[model samples]
Target: MTGSAGGRRARRLAIGTAVMLVLAGTNGPWLYRFGTERYHEYKINRPGYKAVNGHWDVVEFPKEYRQDTIHAVLLHTGKVLLVAGSGNNQDNFDAKRFDSRIWDPVKGTVKKVPTPADLFCTGHTQLADGDILIAGGTKRYERLKGDVKKAGGVMILYNENPDKPMTLPEGTRFTGKGNGKVFLSDDSVLIPRATKVFDRKTGRFLRNNPGYARVVVEAPKEGTRYETGTQDGYRIGGLTGADARNTYGIANKLGMDKRDFEGIRDAYEFDPVAERYIKVDPMNEARWYPTLTTLSDGRVLGVSGLDDIGQLVPGRNEVFDPATKTWTYTRHKRQFPTYPALFLLQNGKLFYSGSNAGYGPDDVGRDPGIWDVATNRFTRLAGLRDPDRMETSGTVLLPPAQDERFLVVGGGGVGESRLSTNRTRLIDLKAAEPRFVDGPRLAKGTRYPQISVLPDDSVLVSGGSEDYRGRGDSDIHQARIYDPASNSFRRVADPLVGRDYHAGSILLPDGRVMFFGSNPLFADKADSRPGVFEQRIEIYTPPYLYRDSRPSLSDGPRTIARGGTGTFTARRASAVRKVRLVRPSATTHVTDVDQRSVALDFTTSRDRITVTVPANRNLVPSGWYMVFAVDGRGTPSTARWVKVP
Candidate 1:
């Protein structure tokens, strides 16, 4: 009886094994994927693997606190200011649901702040007092050609009267002299009085120069028949006597074409301590997608954006005086594409890196150059590879800002073209004739790569799409540590989340890097579903963090003036090899002109390390900076906040 039972059990086991094999054969792909994913998880989490390739962790805020963050700035208080401001959502903009959040990474807390305006696609930079100067934003969302219902375009209103300026109300009507079509202004227009011209050499009076204002106007009713084919003069309505004779409107080709996003003139300064925005003087020009760069004298330079009429700002730049809280037009006029990468030079000039976000004619203001802001003289630099593909490129002032070197990373063609380049260009502004030369190339053509300067002087270049806005699911998950000392890139761990357009990365005070924002065009390779904004912030822990215990810095001075010294206590001071004063980043849209790692001269004795800041104000702008002490093993201590006043 026992032998018979054993035989039956053995037969049953054989049958079960056969059935399992058949099931595996039918579901081979599913089983293979499951096994591969498990193995990958096991490999990446291993102690040895993490020590070499580092790791990435996603930080998802609570559902109620989640927002589509388009701009992020690291404040002196060690909290990140995430600004959304309608978040590129037409519905949110129409509903006036702007958003801002103060995220404390250390405490893992998120606080919602009331946003005053629609700051989407705005420009921001750190101020002398550690306040964030935020300028420009969306006034109206774009409407595609098919979506546009009314015939509308820019109408230039000319004022011939030299005695006074003219203010036209929102509903001001203009009737075309030729087409006989009537159009209404969408907003109030302030047209300055005409300039009375006189000959400079002779005392004779010359003809009056008309002062014009461009305003967006649309036909009251939607139809193809309302479109204008040629330039036409329009008669101003509700005007009499001299006003009617002096003011007239001229417009060309008013049609139901694609309407671009309009800009707002609103500007504000965000107080980090108070966690609120303080309204400041509006800019001279309404701008959308502008670049706010800190000037040498501590004033902020606002440049290059779509104007209130949805046209490119015509090279009219302005400056913001933080002390007076006023904006004044610059003595000169120079233009670039929107969000052009401009950096302050040691000589007080601005360096335009030829990297821009988008929206401009392809041939104009696209060259890398050294711009004399005061004189308005621009010396175009040469040797930039793939010059035509600079839109959406990432530019970085390489570590040790004193070197005056910059790196321009991957970019794509202007607008929605499929052209992209993997080339990385390096330019040494200190050279006799500054020009960009090719550096290491990326494995794949990339756009909107996030570059962060690490505490240890190595730059982490990571996350970009091979196509525009991550089209066709082309988000690159690769990350690399660029060694400036070697001028090479070493591939590191891959980021779990994909970052493309509208994405950026910031170096945290704790020596880690935090990445945020991604607005993809589609969800899948087939491009059927619309993409969602990546609200989950991802933190990258460098390989140095996983190697061994990091050094600790404490008891540091709060403020260290330029050319001054500050002492900090470190238990392992003798092991320290390098010190860096890294300015906190105000990053958005792959542009971060504020971030720079200035190498400091340091001497260690006993348990204390003293570091001296550079005297050059242009190199070390007056602001709060993260002081990091790196050991011989390239491991950096958690930063100590210090102010340069």
Candidate 2:
């Protein structure tokens, strides 16, 4: 009886031990399946579903934007605002075709709105509250008006009786006020008396005596103001509309008329959800061809650009205050050229990498350096191989936002040359005595490449061409991915359309990139000739989309406290290895002034995840960001918007 009982106990123990081992062996898979039920419910990993990698998909819009979309900004409401002011020509402005529209990619809806002013070639920045602050635009355009008669000897109105003998008979009178000359035609002697005679010596006019007036003299001075002479001639009380020359081309090749195309002092905020623009206080100084950069204090810095008079507004950098909805100028140390590539450093300094959209003179203001806004000082750096090629080049702040490193790639030659270069350079601003070091070269030389920072911290460089206006068959259809960790660039899929000149790109919320807008020379006009404005948009999905199962944030607070810890639940927390918050983008001319990716410290327990938010406003800034959960394989989940309050 004792032997039987012992054998039964041993059998029971063996069964219990075997059951424990099985449970232990299958624990990981079971927990993963339990946590990732939401991921599967979405049918993201369903059978027979082919997920493409690093592919470009062209999307059709229900409502096509008839006007060219030269400027684009991604709003926190998950809508993109596109603006093309005047469509690059005077005819479009006259036709009131300058437009602004909001595109909801998820619903495939587009809402067109009226643009108050010509915002073509404007500078834009995203405010902390997700409002867009746009500055500057083409107040006027440099256009060729119809030909005028080439008459410029000057003229003076004469009041003479019909019976009086003509002193200056059908000839030029070389003697007049201030030794000026006047041409007398056959009808000059049969003119009426002058009410006022302008004196060239004193630069003033004398009232004619009615009783003493009989035969009036024809002279260069003393005449009604007209458009027949130079612009100054009308201002000095001369023959206003007689045989005078207006502004004209300086006998250059093409013989195009030259006029001052000034920049507007306008500023405004665009509401993405409402698809409307609210006029804000105008900028203190007018800016055309400006660059808007977001600073650490949540104020937007407006730098560079031509003033109202078509002159460079140098040194005086303007800052937009959201609270006051006004702009304050910061007397900067050095004058930056128009659209200078300005990136805010982690240490509160501005780095001018010399990458600029060509607007000002080529000989001035392409020096790379760190500028101190408070002190108005610049710490210049050396070692750029081709500093002269900084015009229209593409520059980006590399991913892992904490790293104070930037890459400058591909630029055209100075001025109107349009020659592109494949040269690349990098600089680590945090390093002591930082200097630009050689980086990987591009497969094809391009100008105005749109370098978008991807969810996985990789940069997707797309668009651009080897020459201006994409001329000479220089449009590069291929796209490339830049890996910061590898310090290398590799070819990816190609986009359908060619983008250059006024083209732009923005990153969307769903881990996809939206590429839109391209204005070449004449834009969409009949006179645009061989040029075509790109109205269609293309969305690019990175290779990470086709990877293994992705994590999903099932629960989290919409508002996150800056420098505080927040708890959230991810359906696939087991696969999530890291957390990240990427700022929304406001992009134009390959200039994404506010795009940034910040890493978060996180810990996971089953389906629960807690993340530490960055405390420094300089690091994360008070604004809206797309919070993403990245898996071990570098695949990122569709982000959720989290506002840092």
Candidate 3:
């Protein structure tokens, strides 16, 4: 009897060992599985996926909660808030820390949001009301015990004061608390798989538009609302109309295959008060990843995105009038907007830029073109502004009213595919001639979690998964800050965890960033995850003590940091156009370049149109892309274009 028992024990031990090896994924075995499971799918037709690259740089944050990725970072006053999400059930980095956050940047420490013993959640959404709705994740994502799967939707909500974070919201504090507001209302969030909300009802997902319409684009049969976009002129469906689905190219990257891609129409409306979704008539052909911007007329214009086969197609621009319930499509004479940025000038002229950039395939890369409504023409901006460059681009209109100058940041790099950028570019559209100025580069190769400039002139960057373990690797804490005035990063803060694939960064009247984090996958866990996919709120304040704008110093520093070839001599071109540079900032200029010719000074009664790059050694951070901006009244037509390596 004893011998028989020993043999059985031995058998059980061997099996457990094998299981551990499989789960631990020691070496190539783990790599192979990850590659096959996710990366392989992307590598199916494109080589870009196979070349998952990483640019190295030293990071000051040393402690690892086992998991950490900067997802969303925002700054307010002298404080900062960060929101981060986790891809793994453990929530910690790879193997540490829980997956949620609400951190203080200046404090240099993080506070964790504890999961109630009886509560379960996978994701969260934030509402403008300052409460976080935790819903839709695998309430039972981990409920499968020894075979039987047990999943439940346990959505919960939490609120914290940005100035004084909730030390025990009701009882416990959240790790991913501060930074921006999380979307929590049922109407504001979406569950890939149907999620069960508890309490007074967290709400549902609806599209908020000017016509005061609450739009809801239903999920495809068994489809998790993967992506959404609209175009003008083209039929609702691509190629043909009968099959002209209003949404074009909405697909699931991690879900079921074959049905991975779908086309869509160009029109939609939502009724916020009613909490209902209604799809309007279709616009035109299939346009994927189109940018929707609200014009001064309260209309929305979607710029150049792309079609199937990953190519930039014509028939791109579309305009929608909510009041009139009408949508118009326009075919611009410029290159298709692959991943371009849209800027609305005070004069009402629209500026497009930073979309899928082209290179060896000149035809495609050369497609980066800018369209001017006033001139009704497409003229590519001079300098690094190239066609075919589909960088992850967006525009920032400065000041209270938001007019005149615009800031354009990273969108891929020289000769790289669009959708990503490494350097920052400043577009001075207010100048006689709009030009691209060099700003700062991002930390190494990481891309998403999105970036937003706060009301106080500070740059907030957050969230994005690492290549392989990229999802979980990108916790909400991957947050950082950049001070444009000093051209330097101001320490780290806590953030949230999640890919934030299609979340909207709405600017609140209180100056807080309204962050909406959503996943476009129809995974079962998302359904069971209590909060679903929607908004998550976090309040962020910068650490730098704003000492009011310093008065211009006479004969100060005479330097411009242009990547490698050294500074340009400003002597011959010392005069900056008052209409373009000096006047905006009410500042004047004394110009010279490389010390020998790049020194220039200016006075300003108003904010300058752009700023100049300092030309001193160690003047800027390495691996940082440099953008030169003037304070006010300078000729943008003569703005220099360069990047520091």
The top-ranked prediction according to lDDT is 1
Over 342-407, each residue of candidate 2 has an lDDT whose tens digit, in order, gives: 887777778888888877777777788988888877888999977777788878888788887888
Number of the predicted model whose TM-score against the real structure is largest: 1
Enumerate clash totals for all models, in the order shown: 0, 11, 207
How well is each residue in 235-319 modelled by candidate 3, as lDDT tens digits? Answer: 1111234222221111111222221111234343322223222445555433443444435444556544433222344645666
Error of 2 at 441 (Å): 0.8
Each model's C-alpha lDDT?
A: 0.94, 0.73, 0.34
Q: Which ten residues in a row have the lowest lDDT in candidate 2?
A: 247-256
Model 1 lDDT-worst window of ten: 1-10
RMSD of each: 1.4, 17.3, 22.3
Root-mean-square deviation of Cα positions for candidate 3 versus the true structure, in angstroms: 22.3
Model 2 misplacement above 4 A: 1-53, 62-64, 144-257, 521-529
Could you tell me how far off, in angstroms, the CA of residue 161 lies in candidate 2 after the best superposition?
41
lDDT per residue for candidate 1 within 1-645, as digits (tens), equals 356888989999999999989989999899899999999999989989889999999999999999999999999999999999999899999999999999999999999999999999999999989999999999999999999999989999999999999999998999999989999999999999999989899968998899999999999998989999999999989999999999999999999999999999999999999999999999999999999988889999999999998899999999999999999999888878999999999999999999999999999999989999999999989998999899999999998899999999999999998889999999998898878899999999999999999989899999999999999999999999999999999998899999999899999999899999999999999999999999999999999999768888999899999999999999799999999999999998889999999999999999999999999999999999999999999999999999999
